[model samples]
Target: MTPVTSRVEYSPIKRARVYMKHEMGIPERRIALEEGISPGSVSGIIRRYPIQKDATSCARSGRPPKLSDRDKRAILRLIKKDPYITTHNLIVAAGLDVSKRTLLRWLKHEGIVHKPAF
Candidate 1:
């Protein structure tokens, strides 16, 4: 039979142990040894329990918006000027620098509806 290792899938149990161990001032190296993970992983688990933390224990800045507020305003102005404008024409009219699909997603997210071009 293959030998069983201390390694465990990351879950609530491991998170609890890492959090508790950290609260008790246990060193990262020792915690890693006990948890069968890298010291970095142990530290990450400890940080994940904080009130403001997300997965990686740091503020996650998602992808920066491709269009600035000015660009968005321009699109809205273009729409106000002609609500019937097709997505392709809107792109050419506004000189948008994104793909058609990306613009459609942005429009959808901003509550703008498009009549899918014929």
Candidate 2:
């Protein structure tokens, strides 16, 4: 016996395509302007509709960092001088002992990759 197979679908993009091609009559800018979506999004739907097997997660967007240049510089200096420094050392130097995870997050936010000293 063979197992059943099913096709993946994305209703929203499909609807967007229909609106672009038929309901809106292939006017990408008009469709986007009237429907309040990006023109790029309209083009993407028309291009990727048939080839895409499933709905892919859109790339995330976000604001810039909260930390200042001074803060990042301080963190980088500390990491470079003693890459083996523990979270406790970081807390002691930076005056924030939130946790190892929080410390790591800040470090990553500053683009400081950890390299064990030992």
Candidate 3:
């Protein structure tokens, strides 16, 4: 069996703990040795996050999406319940606050083609 230490994804809580130890005046080298990580990693974590609040998550790039996965799933459920329903009704049934065009574009992106009523 592969060892549990083969791959390591450090959690934010652990990083916060390290920061707490650092704030207590523990040396980086000693902290690294005790935590089983490189001294450079310990130093990087200390420098990157100025405050404990920022230590929870790293900075991310790019604009955030308009709709969350839950919203998408909800819409998809509504669609699957009645696939031939028009976009306007779909928006109303889904209780989405977005415009018809925005919902249409998102549906297209998700590979759902709304069928037109005769």
Task: Compute each candidate's TM-score over C-alphas.
Answer: 0.45, 0.35, 0.52
Candidate achieving the largest lDDT: 3
Off by over 4 Å in 1: 1-62, 115-118
> Can you list the residue pairs that collide in candidate 2?
none
Poorly placed runs, candidate 3 (over 4 Å): 1-9, 52-54, 83-118
lDDT by residue (29-103, candidate 2, tens digit) is 876676566777666666765554454434435655455567557667877898888777876786553567766
Q: Write the per-residue lDDT of candidate 3 for residues 1-118, one digit (tens) a residue.
A: 1235553556887788788899999999999998888888898888866764646654545667667788799899988898788888987887888888888889888888845679
How would you order the candidates by TM-score, starting with the best? 3, 1, 2
- Model 2: how far residue 87 lies from native, Å: 1.4
Comparing 1 with 3 on TM-score, the higher-scoring candidate is 3
| Residues 86-110, model 1: lDDT tens digits | 8899888888898889889889988
lDDT, residue 66, candidate 3? 68
